[model samples]
Target: MAEVHRVEEKTFEFEVPVVIVGAGAAGLVAALAAREAGADVLVIERDSVPRGSTALSAGLIPAPGTRFQKAAGIEDSPGLFARDILAKAHDEPDGDQVALVTREIGPAIEWLADNHGLAFSVIDDFTYPGHSARRMHGLPQRSGEELIDALRQAAEAAGIEILCDAHVTDLWADATGRVLGLGLVRPDGSTDEVGCGELILACNGYGGNKALVAEHVPSLSDALYFGHEGNQGDAILWGEALGAASRHLGGHQGHGSVAHPAGILISWATVTEGGFQVNLNGERFSNEAKGYSEQAAEVLRQPEGLAYTVFDERIAGIVRQFEDFRRAEAMGIILTADTPEALAERMNVPSGMLAETFAEVSRLKAEGARDGFGRDFSGVADLAAPYHAVRVTGALFHTQGGLVVDDAARVLTRDGAVLPNLYATGGAACGVSGKDASGYLSGNGLLTAVALGRLAGQAAGRRVAIPASA
Candidate 1:
């Protein structure tokens, strides 16, 4: 809500064939795609730097049947990936959106690697909660910072002009919702009007807006808002104001294991690879294998709205590839103990109860039994002495829903007609997550970000020039 205006009264200082807002993963990828299609692109970023929510993620994008997956000897297809999403969502989402993203994800990933010089490698070691295959692709560092840095480098190399610190306050359009230009408010109180042949809204969702979060995702109203400050729902608000249809506004992505106070994301790999969560009462709550998105609320619903992630040194070695975990280790947040009692002592929880919890977990895993909460302990390794634990709290990461669009990433009016020359991608568009945070499978954000971004850019690059009289 910084300002989303339909003010059509501006004089143009310059123009581009394609203008993209919010130069994150989505916007930058869109610029690249447009450039490839022979369009001159301008990526306008709100921040002085280009890092947005993409810098706050694990930089993982799930794609099926990619070269990375093939090299890992993992068999996966778009059908199986779609099935995993539908099965894990537990509620109905847009079937068309699911199918679109699944189909485009593989091609998008390969395109970035083959054309843009992004060194993507599949996470072949372990799978996330709801994913059956090792399809998570990331850069060498496996951090969102590296991801955004690479995308920015790629955009710069493509000669895409990314105007930084020029806050886009108004979107200019005619009565028909056909975009004419955008008004940018600069730092010195000066303004510049830039005409565009086509516009792409890649501004992220409304997680940082407390009023919107309280209004939509009330469950995370008091949770930690960990998204970028620029995610003020400008695209969503602007699209809605322009009579665009929106859906699932209450949906979002949340995390249960962000290191408390430290504020770095503890990769969910710690849980999916056999670690578990327990509250201050030294009791397991929901099945930890359940998706991390839902676990945010579960962790927040605990006694003190906090929980602990318990893992072994072996699991620590597995997750060390993440820059966040390595940072936590550097900060001494990953406490270690030689026994359950000792670990509980370090955590200041009841030693007796902690020992009992560990014993129960070991018994269940040894016997290949299922817990009451429906998490199967079968075939999973048990945590031994020299265990590692981190105090964590739940956090609201980002909103999942926004303006509704078709498979081609065109913004649709409430009447189901396409808005000419305007598109929404990334958090501006409705994501693959179905209804709420619980339905967010891992990598759904970046999957749709790159996939829809490329689609929108390609479509925008091919759009016809605006009529002279408008």
Candidate 2:
């Protein structure tokens, strides 16, 4: 931990209706929502450039029964979404949190699109793992950068001031535990205090902290971390100091197919469309249908933590619309060949074994058989001529747990009591996923981020008693 300057006795320099720490998706959304609900807002970010774990994501947000889904003629509901989460996160802590997210996701997304001018549409082409319907709503580019850019634009237009390079050092509170203001250290080592009636912590989790990872997620201690370096568990530490309760500290989101040298994410859509992963021995190890996060542990256990995603031209074409996949292809990370043998030769694997693997996949698809690894090839197509492969490895994207909060996004103590005037969202709050990498359903990160952010901002706005014009 680096030394952070905290002055216990100093006059606060500024005051706002709501002060948001960490200008990622959660902070930006909270600012927008708070301002919309008639509150003055300020967002302080650690990085000079505001790219957090949210910007590294695929920008997919799952919201069942949204107007976009209805326009696309897809039948879904929050009940179904909650059921899917419970099914995946069985026996995991904070199941109610999952239910709260499911219930509010639709409205949260709709509010952003309708009121904040955010552009989002239903991903009607294919469904992600654990989602019975195509409920993913994303920007046109399907990139988190685009989403963040849009949110920043909206925040700026709404008069939300985002101060970058403002690293928050501590929260100023009285003996009653009611947060009064925040302490910050500027990049030049200058310290300042900013007062606020309410505070929202959106700084995210501790994936970049090696000590926290080794303590909570020991299984992935050796895996590569691909999330933002700014997520240093400040929210968790601050919450702990405030006597806040925590939940699901072991849960995380993992990526199974990060391109080895290029470090680009290979979209899971390719795997769902027909692609498969094979180890260096030219042998399929686990079920590709298990989804990216769930398959990450399996990929980590592979020989030297290396695997190849083998697909055909058809699957590539189907998934090329994704910005990351297209970027990978443009970077020459995707290898192409006319035959399985040629592809295997290009991958430096035995041609006979690779051919045998493809033959087995085709035979199983033809006979409608279950694979030895419990993979079902029901909807996948047989690989045709002109194959494609990308060398990839597993990586830890972000932690999924932090300060436990109520449905209103107010921070809670171990005894289930709310901490006055303090709230948490995004990775700062406990996630809906279970206490493992496998419990992460697609888009759960952004779902909680945007939804709880909105809830927190609205609650703060109403509680602050600020004028509508402020």
Candidate 3:
């Protein structure tokens, strides 16, 4: 057995059935489920505030076969959802894992709604790319902050203790790879120890860590990272130290239409609702329908790493239901014009070229012609009068890769052996989006977070009793 280091300082030590790191979507949901399964759970967060990348998201979760989908008269199944994911991630490394998440996502959402009293409604206005069914669900406010708030409320009501500003510096595990507990650095510069029967790493990914970005996802190293700074990859480091295998290290989610200077998301609904991105030359460079994550690289390659999202009043109206778009509009970030020429002038692009681009889009829609950039305009209508535009740039939202795990959310070793008493979910675990940004189907992040989190929590809760030291 490896020698265990003992802390001599007069601080504090506590024991629980499960000790979770990070207080984001994953940790909170895990705590709820574990407590439901009769385990004593505690959550530790590095930040004083609990918000992480999940709060910065649109809070969309894709769950097929949900009660909301059935009530909306949409026929769907986990098999169909798995097919959509596999089709998008054409050579996905872990098809079984993708299928596992798909199977559990619906029940996870139902559990949140029924057991926890969290409310969600389907996003029926527009369908996100790569999903055959309209199954994206969100809070009434359609914001991640709202979802996090709901989860936090549910956790608190369940008596789950969440300690913020407590940074976990180390995991104490025996030589057999059984996690014993964690070392925490308190806000007052004091050190403490927490002993638990199980540990769940939910601290998110390494998108904010420049060195990790360069090492695993070099192509996106230069792009602006919009994820929370707290996602410094503590889970990856600790998992690796315990010989946990990692997968899909290059996979990430990127947003292509973050409003430049204004620093707010323009909502992909603009592009999905017949809007298009143009470079400084006022030319369409790529298919706008490829989805935000896939089109991020193309947007980054534009001149000065900037582009403009051009849409019409019809498109704007269709997307304005989203709070992010509404917020952007209220902030006066969305520029409006009566003609393509005026819009181009407002955007500082070539007026004639912009007009020509608009004409081409109209011609394609009229003649049923395939776009030169490989976009299918059959489903999209031409832009009418009263144009809208938002100057935009691409950004890495979060990394989708981390510790490898099985269907139970149990972290695994390089040789495919399970790490006893340790689990991971959310950005700390490998996602189902293959190994790059292009394979990220919408809502994969939160789906994995909630589904795997619930599974990990239940599994941990049922296995061990609270330590007598508590």
Candidate 4:
């Protein structure tokens, strides 16, 4: 671990109505909602606000039933969303946290679009394979930075105080084992204790810290992280030290076919549906019509656990229209050659096998066989010369595990006891999607982050600041 500069002993005393750890999507939402409910909220972050994974993500807000849904003529309900989420949670997930996310996702998404001025379009639910509903909500800005900026702006306008570069090293519990405050190590090598009426943990996942990754998520200990670099799982560690248990510790979505080398995330919409993906052997593997989650697992099944996308000048033009092209090129999956045989050689595959693979693809395209990809692959197939290949591989997204919380977003311990005054939401809490889907559910992360964050904020406000006392 890098030695972060800690501030000196400073007793910064404030009657903080709520202390929020981590200013990512979940934390930001919690802070904003809590403040709007008339609580003096403070958000302590390890990094500058608007710089966490939430800031770096594609700003796709997945609200099931909103004005946007009506505008797009899509049918959905909170109940349906909950059913899909619960189905996934049944497979190796924390049941309580999953339930919380499902119960509140619709309302949370509505809150963002309604209260936060988030411009979004309700298309079919972002379809990970196995999803029954077309439930993905896409943002006009299409970047996590926009969402972060909007959330932070809302929080600031509501008179919330955001402390940046303050790493939360430990949780401050009362004598009765209730969380009261936090131990903050600032950037200047100084230490300060900030008191709070309630604490909300939203510090995100442990993908960035190798040691923590091994300690928690053993499945992907060596897995590459495609999210922000600041998600080090501090909240999880602190919660564990204070006798809080976690779920899905070694479990997360292995996002399929990210833009390699560029470290940017591209929706599976583009790769599985838009681009041509192949295995390391320079041959097409699974049916491209499957969901990205299923495609990601098949790709990992390769000898090197990676795949590549091969396209011609025609597909290249399509890829160029998107801004994530740089990332595609960096991952070594996107390469160009003069002919099919040469392209195969560049990827170190059997030349004859490559030729046969392309021939089979051409035959399949001509036949117009349904591959179950819906309409996303309507125009794909049938490519010409100037071939290109993009190395597609799986990457660890948010962990679907952490401190368990109920539908109200209250943290629950191993023995089913509610940890009073301590609430958790977002990636810091366990994910709602479980084994029901092959990969992470498309919009569940954002959904739970906003929904559970709101629930926690509201509950924390009621618990910490009583109306009678006020």
Top-scoring candidate (TM-score): 1
Cα lDDT listed for each candidate: 0.90, 0.88, 0.88, 0.68
Pairs of residues clashing in candidate 2: none
lDDT of 4 at 281: 64
Rank by lDDT (best first): 1, 3, 2, 4
Per-residue accuracy of model 3 over 1-470 as CA lDDT, tens digit each:
11234333322367777899989999999999899989989999988878888889988899999999988988889999999998887768588898899999999999999999989889887889999999999888788988998999999999999999898887677777887777888779997888888899888999989999999888778998888987888898888888999998899999899999777877887888788899989999999888899777888999998999999999888777678888998898899999999999999999999999999988888887788778888867778889999999899999998899998999999999999889999999999888898889989899899999999999888787554464
Question: Which ten-residue region of model 1 has the weakest summed lDDT?
Answer: 461-470
The model with the greatest lDDT is 1
Query: TM-scores, in order shown?
Result: 0.97, 0.96, 0.96, 0.83
What is the C-alpha local distance difference test score of candidate 3?
0.88
What candidate 4 gets wrong by more than 4 Å, as runs, is 1-12, 86-100, 124-128, 274-276, 285-305, 311-351, 362-388, 435-439, 467-470
Cα RMSD for candidates in order: 1.9, 2.3, 3.0, 4.8
Task: Give one digit per residue, the lDDT tens place, for model 1 in 112-224.
Answer: 99999999999999989889888999999899999999999999999899999989988778888878898888888898889988899999898888889999999999999
- State candidate 2's TM-score: 0.96
